[model samples]
Target: MTDATANTAPAGAGQGSLLIKDSRTAKRNGAEGRFKMYGLIAVCIGIAMLILLLTSILTSGLSAFWQTTIQIEVTLPEEKLDKSGVRDPEVMAKVTTFGYAPLLRDGLEATIAANGIETELSAKDAAELISDESVAQLRNRVLRNPDLIGQTVSVEVMASGRIDGFYKGRVTYASAERDTNISPAQLQLAEALEDKGLLNTSFNWLFLTAPDASDTRPEAAGLGVAILGSLYMMLIVLVLALPIGVAASVYLEEFAPQNRWTDLVEVNISNLAAVPSIVFGILGLAIFINFAGLPQSAPIVGGLVLTLMTLPTIIIATRAALKSVPPSIRDAALGLGASRMQSVFHHVLPLAMPGILTGTILGLAQALGETAPLLLIGMVAFVREYPEAPWEGGLFDPATALPVQVFNWTQRSDPAFVERASGAIIVLLVFLLLMNLTAIFLRRRFERRW
Candidate 1:
């Protein structure tokens, strides 16, 4: 029996082999480990780049949120503002911005004199410390509050762009010495006024709340109009893009026949997604503005153009999301005595809703940051006035979008617009972040495991 067992066990049965790995297997494992290390390094580099971008944006843009203001006491001589002595607003409305300019200049001079902030600047040069828009601002204030016309009112007005840049560290003393816009003595006066509690750097809520000022009044410039314009365009895009995109996606994914025509349509849709945004801009300019006669620079036109641009993206995302749903869900719904339409709508559509909404919002966010198309549609035009209420004439009113506004500001000669553009970018990023976060939340909220 022992001889039979030895023969059956075959040759070398008593010899044992070591459990060491094969050389090829070891090399493969080492290669895998190195690949993982490379991947980790790549991820770390991406994270570092993201951090650097955010840090640069925040540091450069945060200064726009704080503005240097010169607090002045203006004695509104009755002879100048309230000659009628009736304290009537209608009478005050007749006083043009020119009529109000001397008062602001006198106020700045008096403030400097009262604070003993002596400088080499003359009375005119001292007044130049304040924004040119201050005249209009003061006139509007008096028109709004006629009783203030006869009173010595203390007002905090925005400093000129150059003066504000002095406090923001953008304009150094040496730079001011060479700049034709402002003198170094003005900076000295500003410093003294700051010490006297008259000049200050405060949180500028006006950056969010006020409208854009003239090219020369960058300190008083704000994103309010641009924000509203973007909001309006988003509303229009959301309303138009979601329904149309989803409908097209649904038909193409589930209902449409598989044929050459359908294949051609699908290929076109895919190509549209990759098309340059500037091409969409040109299309919008030609089709919407020229042919359709829609008002240029209006949110309605911008929204329509964006809707066209965003449709391909939304359709692609929605179709991919629909395809992700298991065929078993549809079969089960149909087997349970449901029609094809009911099966798709009740079971498949609900499951795909999260992805649909996510994709739509992401598309909208993309549209919100678009500038080229808007520029072609004339949204790059300067817009200082706020649009009417949405239901009234807001959609048709000429407006400037946030990205276009940033572009416009960057093109200006004023250094302060640099800060404004950066600040606008921060605002745009916040919006994009919020939209992306919402997309994430929606995806997680309704995602199904089956």
Candidate 2:
């Protein structure tokens, strides 16, 4: 009996030894520390790449925020600004920007002489060193307020793009030989004027408030008009896309049966989300612009195109959100004699709202940065005037979006417009970042777990 008991104990110890061997084998087959470290290195590399991208954008874009300006005291003789002391609108209409050029030239000459700067530059050349927009600006103000037409007013005028670049060290005298807009003489005069405090650099509010200018008026160009156009398009997108997308998502996720037709729809939606944005632009051009006869280059058409593109993303997100709600919760609500709609609307939808909002904002950010679609829809056309009310002539009027404006500026020959393009990009990126941040905030604020 003792021998038999000893034999059973040895067998039990052998089985335990086998189990320990198997456990050791499993640990040996698991991922190694080196493999895990490789993943960590990959993540670190990705973060470094992201930092490099941000640093490049910020460095190139920071210069766009400031501009060179010249402060001039100009005596607007009543003869030029207001031909008739009676302030006749007809007389003011006849006075062109050219009429104000002489006054600016005179002011520049006075400034140069007063500063005792010895230069061979003529008054015309000195004034040309400043922006042509300044002439128009002075003329417009005098016409608007005829009371100031005869008075000597202190005005701060934007410097010419080349002059501005020169002052900022972006354009040196050596580079000016290739530039047709400015010369070394102009640069020297600008330096002399800077020394006398008549010319200086300051934060460029006009870049935010003014509109796009001609190729010759880069210093005068601003993002205000394009920003408005983008806003209008977004307004249209939000008003139309959000409700329709959410409704479709709810029906598909909560009520639609798992049929072949539903399957086809789901598959097609996923494909549409993957379609290139340029395809949507082509679709918009064919359907909205050519076939439907919607106004070309209008924000309305742009909005419609963006709405179609954004819908797939929003629907996918909303459905995912709805699916995240626990099935037990839905069953409980239904078992309490609540309708399917009631169960979804009361329990499921509230839980899904945060995800839905986050997705919508991300989609809108995508739309905001879209340039290819706008390019196809004639948003590349130059727009000089602001559109009217949304319900009025707005949908038919020519408009330029921010991205489109940036694209247009980059294509110009002027170096200053490059800076303007960079500035526009900065503005667009700010909007995109804000939208993304809002998505993050929404996710954190309303996220729930079952």
Candidate 3:
């Protein structure tokens, strides 16, 4: 019986050994490993998608930053221009773009003839090599310097959009065959002109500094107005939203009593953060536009709408930042004879400030890219004229935002407009990048370890 008991005890001890792996434990470990791998794959996928998006944006938009321009020595015949012996501004203004077209065509012809660029294109088709805005551009130049109208002056004029696209690889020789806008002969002529230094590509500063152009003048299009409008809206939002958001958050988190009313307000604020941005657009349209009678397409209205959308986000972030502060901080301040208000303001608010600023800037970045709210407020209109200076009714003037401009450009039939749209996106992304960097810098600068 002792031998039999000894054998059973040895078998029981072997069965209870910790070295043996349990089936369930092995399965759980395998599952955890697979989950980690999945998370890693997700992160890699996200990074790949970001890289692809950036690559596409840069590829499609980089061409918009440079332009093809032709150098021509134009002999503005005295007979055609300033026909009235009096070099009067009003008389010059009466000479329409048509009156200037012949001089531009003649200049291009002379440049081609002198540079030995032989082409089958007639004087009419040669005129096609220049942008539709070239006449107006020349007119404006002459208007700015009236004495130069009759003088032989060297001027740089923008090449046609198709010619610009050709150099940028958007228009190929074969594609130009079917395109009525440009022919292969024209492309060859352009190449010859390039070789002789009559035509060249250079950085297009006008695109960044000038205003939007009409559909017929894509080469002259620019983002300056849109950028200015967005800047104005952001200024309005920063002025109105930051102070109001911080004050509301401070009151609710630190001072407000925990009651049903407060609870309801908190719940509503949370809900608002999740609401669709377009709903705020509708609310703005109804209240600000319809009720208050504010000007449609004004930056002020857009700012107010975005301020509402940003408020809840700011509140949520500020509260979370406040809540992250340790209770010990409050107690220590109180123990030091600080009042409740003083304790919160002097101790808690400072600690939470980094998060508040980060969140507020992030919220503003989000607002900067928003199109829906601005769309409903009539900011989608074709705004050719720039907004007046701030003192001269700029806020109330008709102006378009960057996102709305992008939307408008995409709707156009011209492929050059698409490039313009992409370029605008690059600019918008740059602004967002700067804002986010500022947030990160501020966070690190003010972050507290305790």
For 1-450, candidate 2 gives per-residue lDDT tens digits of: 323333365445335443244443445445465688899999999999999977776666667789899988888788767656789767787978777889988977776777788889878778887799998888788777888877788888889888888866789989988777788988988888888898889999888778889998888998877988898998888888899999999999989999999999999999999999999999999999999999889999999999999999999999998888889999999999999999999999999999899989988998898999999999998888888878886866788899999999999987778888888888999999989999999999999877
**lDDT (Cα, tens digit) per residue for candidate 1, span 54-141:** 8998888999999888899998887888788898888877778888888988888888888777787888988888888777888888
lDDT of 3 at 355: 95
Segments of candidate 3 deviating more than 4 angstroms: 1-25, 77-91
Better of 2 and 3 by lDDT: 3
Cα-based lDDT for every prediction: 0.89, 0.86, 0.89
Candidate 2 minimal-lDDT segment of 10 residues: 13-22
TM-score per prediction, in order, is 0.93, 0.91, 0.91
Residue pairs in collision within model 2: none
Q: Evaluate model 2: give its lDDT.
A: 0.86
State model 3's lDDT: 0.89
Error of 2 at 291 (Å): 1.2
Best candidate according to TM-score: 1
